[model samples]
Target: MRKKLIEAIKAAFLSEGYGFFQGFADKIQGSELTLPALWLTPIEVAGMSGRNDGKVTYKIVLYLFVQNEQYDEQQKEEKWEELERIARKGIATLPMISDVISTDKVTIKPDEFAFTSFGELSQTVTFLADVYFCNE
Candidate 1:
């Protein structure tokens, strides 16, 4: 189930012509991030109920980076909007996974101070993927 979710996310971002990575190191260095990238962090997994047939949910946070060559506020906001659209499109597929039963809405927050030194704008997108499975 985790693998499915991860693949879906990668496809979603990759379809939009951006790079996808699985950690914080590249995102923080700014210099390391290839502009127009999504950094994925699988935060936690928790069983939704005690019953064996119950659902299990996982939390994921995606860090989106887009280049802002001149550090223009208008361009930054536009990039944020674009990233939000891509995030929503990705979240919409959670229910399509065979084991996935539901998903929370995508929550996006702009990091105004993030990676400014490298002329990049960043945003954080968070969502929950809930699935019903006997074993993960």
Candidate 2:
């Protein structure tokens, strides 16, 4: 199920011609992320419980890490907003899952967005995009 979500998210980003990004990623997917890249990982899954009548609800926590070069707090703040915008756009761009799944009750939204600096030019922003869906 996690893999399916990852593939779907990756496909959506590709279809939208998004910038450097990865799904099902543990660390940087490629060399240094080019200073402006996005990473998606399913950090956790909520307890699953529901009816056995061919439908099940699932909740997933997908962490999105966006990195950009920032020299100071002001720059970090500016880029954090941009990263938030990008993250939301990416989530909105996600295509519907397979036909077997029912998204009628599904919802996707940003749980949180944060900014931190690693070094003089290495500033990173992270956010959690919570995904809720139903599948058989």
Question: Which one wins on TM-score?
Answer: 1
lDDT of 2 by residue, 1-136 (tens): 5566666666655554444454354454333543333455443444444444333334433433444454367866665565566555655554354322432223333323332233222223233233444555
Give per-model TM-scores. 0.81, 0.49
Cα lDDT of candidate 1 equals 0.74
In angstroms, the error of model 2 at 90 is 1.7
The residue-by-residue lDDT of candidate 1 on 29-126, one tens digit each, is 64466778888875579547757677778888888888776746787778788878877777776566345677785589998676536667788888
- Global lDDT of each model? 0.74, 0.44
The CA lDDT at 56 in model 1 is: 78
Please report the candidate that would top lDDT against the real structure. 1
All models, RMSD in angstroms: 2.7, 6.4
